[model samples]
Every structure is written in C-alpha cells, then in structure tokens.
Target: MAVIATLADVRDTDPVDLTPLQSTVDPEELDSLVRVRNGANGDTHVTFTHEGHAITVHSYGMVAITPEHELTAEKYERGEGR
Candidate 1:
C-alpha cells in the first residue's frame, strides 16, 4: 500500500486507478521477505519498475522510487538482479 501510495504521489495520480501492484510484485512474497529480512537484521530491499519508475521497498518500511533507467545489467552479470 505504501509503495502504491508513494508511486501515485510521485506520479501525481490516484492510487485506485493505477495498475495493481501484484502485476509487478507478489504481495505475499514481499511481505514474507520483508518480515524475514527484518527478523534477521538484513539490509533487505526489493526493486522493480512500476508506473514508469523504479520502486524499491526496504525492510525498514521505506519506499523509494525513481525514474525508469537501465539498472539491471550489472546485477544481471553478477547474477543478483533477481
């Protein structure tokens, strides 16, 4: 919800009319990942492009977004882009 809200704000649009977050990320997996990473004290985040921006959700309940860019080549080369 936070991610969606933030994206909507960044894009200056309504949340309900935006494409579903589930289209870009699995809600259950995201919740589980954040919970487990926080429990383990890991510096965890999940990043994906949504609504023309890069959305990164952190384990500390922070949502970050930026304009779309090519950000996966290096990570993919190192096999960590997933």
Candidate 2:
C-alpha cells in the first residue's frame, strides 16, 4: 500500500514543511520537494520542486493542485470570489 504523508509528518525530515497543502505530483515524473509557511489570516507560501526547478505559490486556507503549475494566493482568493 502507498503511504500518504502530511506536512507535519515531514517537518523534521531533510526537506521541511513550509505549507499545509498536500503533494499531488506524480512520483514517476520526478522526485519532489515542497515547503510551506503559514501566513497571516490563513495565508501561506507553498513551494514545489522537481529535479532542480522550483515554483512558489501563495494560498489562503486551502490549496489547489494541478499538473502544470500552482497558483498564487491572489489567484486562489480571486477564484473563490471572496
């Protein structure tokens, strides 16, 4: 069976948890590294790494994942129409 790990679980690992969001990247594609930082009022900075390339995303309360790119907090909030 596959194991699902959360940010809190990997906190002390070589890679740290900087966000509360989960990883959805395909393992077959590349090994991934992620970081998340809790921000003001549920805001957070989420970063993902594949190979040596990294992408940062800002999200509030929740995060949206996709195959191509991660969206920023501004974009996420806007999508919510809040």
Model 2 residue 33 distance off true place after TM-score fit, in angstroms: 15
Q: For residues 1-82, what per-residue lDDT tens digits would candidate 2 score against the true structure?
A: 0111333232333234333223545433322222233454465445565322243444432332232333345566678534
How much does each candidate deviate from the true structure in C-alpha RMSD? Answer: 5.1, 12.6
**For residues 18-62, could you state the per-residue lDDT of candidate 1 as single tens digits?**
999999889889887765354557668888888778888888888
Off by over 4 Å in 2: 1-42, 60-82
Per-prediction TM-score to the true structure, in the order listed: 0.73, 0.22
lDDT of each: 0.81, 0.36
Which pairs of residues have clashing backbones in candidate 2? Answer: 18-36, 18-37, 19-36, 58-73
**TM-score, cand. 2 vs. native:** 0.22
Backbone clashes under 3 angstroms, per model: 0, 4
Model 2 lDDT at residue 55? 39
Winning candidate number (TM-score):
1
Number of backbone clashes in candidate 1: 0
